[model samples]
Target: MPYINVRLTRKDITTEQKAQIVREITATMQSVLGKRPESVHVVIDEIDPENWGYAGELTSVHRKRQG
Candidate 1:
């Protein structure tokens, strides 16, 4: 069995896109890692900009500065 955790900042990702990611991740594990699709687990976590930060600043602030 394989467990995969995917974390990303909250963005404009659609439900379809998330499903694609899950499918791809599971398929990759099954094909390359020899793990069964039924045994592969993919978990996605979407963090809020305020809760997710980099370079000593929050993501919300970073996006504002980028604008």
Candidate 2:
């Protein structure tokens, strides 16, 4: 089984975009590693910006500064 974890801050990502991500990842595993699509597990972990940090600051802070 190929387990893939996709972590992203909850933002403006559409439902179709999320589904496409899962489909492509599973396809990659199936093609590259010969893992069956049914055996490929893709987990999308949506995180709150306040809880996701980068460069010693939270993502929410980064976005606020950008705005």
Candidate 3:
């Protein structure tokens, strides 16, 4: 069995997008690790903008600065 954890800052990504990501990742894991998709566990974590940080700044702030 393969355990996968995916974390992302809270954003406007649609459910379809998330499902696609999960499907692709699961396929890769199944091929590379020889694990069945049904045996793989995928966890998607949606983090708060204030809690998720990068480059010494929160995600929201960082994105705003970059944009």
1-67 per-residue lDDT for model 3 (tens digits): 6788999887887999999999999999888887888998888999988898788888888878779
Return the clash pairs for model 1, or none.
Answer: none
Off-target runs (Cα >4 Å) in candidate 3 are none
Where does model 2 exceed 4 Å of error? none
Rank candidates, TM-score, best first: 2, 1, 3
lDDT of 2: 0.93
Model 2 Cα lDDT, one tens digit per residue, 1-67: 7788999999988989999999999988988889989899998999999999999999999999999
For 1-67, candidate 1 gives per-residue lDDT tens digits of: 6888999998898999999999999989978988879998888999999899899999999998999
lDDT accuracy of residue 4 in candidate 3: 85
* Candidate 1 RMSD to the real structure: 0.8
Which order, best to worst by lDDT?
Answer: 2, 1, 3
TM-score of each: 0.93, 0.94, 0.85
Alpha-carbon error at 8 in model 1, in Å?
0.3
* Local distance difference test, candidate 1: 0.91
